[model samples]
Target: MDDPQRSLLYRWPTAAKFDRRVPKEKLYEHGTGTPAVREKFVAEVQRITWAFKLAETTINLAGNTAVPEIQIFEIDAKGTNVTEPVLTAIDKAIPFPIIFEINRDDGETRSTRMVAAHKQLGSGAPKIGAYYSTGWQSARTERQSLPTAITLPALYTALLDPLTPMAARPGEDVSEVAARLKAMRKLEREIAALERKLRTETQFNRKVELRRALKTKQAELTMLVER
Candidate 1:
C-alpha cells in the first residue's frame, strides 16, 4: 500500500542544534494540531532518531489524521523573570512567523503580538510589521480569540501566501538564514561521521587522520557559525 503520510517526512536540519545543545530537552511533548505542527514535530523526531523502523512507524501513526493546532510549545512564564529567555530562544529557533499567547496566573490571556507580519516598504521590498497583534487570524488586528483548530490547508496558506509575508523578526533575511542553516547542517553531518570513524578505528595512524579531519570539519563549522 502507498503511504500517504510519507509526504510529511520533510527534513529539519536546524533541529539538530537543539539536540546538540540541549540533549535532554523533550521534543514534541505537546503536539501542534496543524500540518505545519505535524511537519515540525516529525522533523524533530527524525532529527533525533536514526532508526528507519521507528521513523516508519511514526510516519504511519501521524498519517491517521490532522494534528492539533498548537505552536512549537507554550510557555507559562507569566510573572516569571525567565519569560524573556524563553521567548528569545523561541524567536531564534523558529524562523517562520508565529503567534504567541501569554496567559497570566489570574486567568487573563493577552497575546504578545505576532513575531513577523509582512508589509510593503516604499522601495518595493517587504518588511516586518511594526505593529504587534494578539492573534494571527488576519494581518489587520490583534484582538481576535485564539483559533480552536488549525487545519492543514490553513497552515499551508499561512506559510505559502506571497501576499501575506511570513518573515517576522527584525533584520531577518529568510534566504540568508536558510542558506547558513543548510551549510551548518552539512558540516554537522560530516563531523558526526568523522567522529564515528575515529571511535571504531584503533590504528594509531588512522586515529591521527580522523582527528585531523574532525578538527578541520569543526573549524569549517565554526567559521560558518561565526559568519
Candidate 2:
C-alpha cells in the first residue's frame, strides 16, 4: 500500500518553495479541516533542519482548517523561544510574514524574517497547513520594547575610530580632529585588507576578535562626536 501521508508531506512542485500537493479523495475528507498544505510544510522544515539550525519541531492543529502553526527549535538567541505559536499569535497570517530575533554569541541580536501561510495546489497528496517560511538572514535589530532610543548597533571596530566621519565638504579648518579621523580610517582599512588576505580559520577568528576589541574604542569616539 502507498504511504499517503508521507507522499503528500514530501512532494514539491517544480518551482514552489513548499509541497502543496494533495490527493483528491482526502481533500473531500479533511481539506475542510485546515490547510491540506501545512502538514507537508513542517515535513519540509524537518528536512532543512541543517540550514535553520532548528532543533525540535512540532505542528499543532489550530481552529483554522486552513492554517497550522509550527514549533521549531531555533539554536540562536532568546534561548529557545517558542516559535510557531508566536507566529499563530500574530494576525492569523495568510501570506505569513513573521519577524523574530536571533541572539548572537557576541551579545548582539539579529533580526529574522519568515513566512507562514497557504499554498494552493493541484491534485496530489494532502496534509495540514504549516508555518510556512523561506529562511532567515542577518538584518537590523532594535532593542526589545524600547524601539525609539537605539537603532541597529552599527558595526565599527575601534580601529576605525581614528577615521574622520562626514568628510568636511569644504576647507572647514581641517583641524586636529579631521587628521585623527583620517588616520583612524586608514588603519581600519589596513586591518580589513589584511583579514581578507588571510586564508586560515584560526587566524581569521583571531582577526575577528581583534576587530571586536576595536569596537569598544570605536564606540567611545563616536559617542564623543555625538556629545
Candidate 3:
C-alpha cells in the first residue's frame, strides 16, 4: 500500500491564501439543510475556515469552465470522526470543488486527515460522488509541493489521485477512476453479502449455488483490480 501521507499534502502559496473564517450559520444559509445536518455541525464541528483558493488569477494556471477554482477548507473537528452527512452538507453549500482538511486534537497530540468527494457540475446541481480519505497523521507531518499541472482541472485530478483507493491507469482521468471505484464498491458489497449467505446455508444444493454466485462476484472484483 502506498503511504497516503506522502506527496499528499501541498504547501499552498502565500499569494493564493484566502484566510477567511467561514461561519457555520453561513453554510446553513447557503443551502446546507435539515435539522439533523445542522445539529451534526453544531455537535461535531468546532470551526470552518476557507483556507486557500487555487485559481488562474492566484496560481497562474489556466482554469477550465467546469472547474474555475478549487477551494481548500479546513475543519476543526470536535470529535475523532465527522460523518458523511456533515461533509455532504458542506459540499452542497459550496458551488466549487473543495478539498477538506479535518483536524482533531486528543489533548496529548494533534492529528489531521484529508477528505473529499469527486464533485461534478451539472445543469441543475453539483453531483457529489463517494468520499475518499486518508488516515490520520500527525499535524507536524512533512508536506509536499502541489502536483504539476497546466490547468485547474488537471491539478484537481492530480490532487485527488493520492486519496483514491486504486491507482489511476495510463490515460485514465479522475472521472474514469471515480467510475471504476464505484463499480468496485458495488462488487465488494455483493461479494460480502454472498459470503455471509454462504456461511449459514446448510442444504448441499443451496450451499453449492451460493458458492457459485460468490465465485462470480469475486472474479469480477479481481478483473477490476487488474484494470
lDDT by candidate, in order shown: 0.36, 0.30, 0.84
Estimate the TM-score for candidate 2.
0.19
**How do these models rank on TM-score, best leading?**
3, 1, 2
Q: Which sections of candidate 3 miss by over 4 Å?
A: 1-8
Error of 2 at 53 (Å): 31
TM-score of each: 0.31, 0.19, 0.88
| Model 2 alpha-carbon miss at residue 115, Å | 2.2
> 2 or 3: which has the higher lDDT?
3
Clashes of each: 7, 26, 0
Q: In candidate 3, residue 194 scores what lDDT?
A: 90
Candidate 1 residue runs with Cα over 4 Å from true position: 1-96, 99-172
1-227 per-residue lDDT for model 3 (tens digits)? 22465434678878899999999987966784889888999999999999999998899998776688999999999998677788888899998999998899978998888888888866777888888888788888788889888888888888888887777776666677778888999999999999898998899999999999999999888888674
Query: lDDT rank, highest first?
Result: 3, 1, 2
State the displacement of the C-alpha of residue 79, model 1, in Å, after optimal TM-score superposition.
22
Assess the local accuracy of residue 6 in candidate 3 as a C-alpha lDDT between 0 and 100: 48
Give the best candidate by lDDT. 3
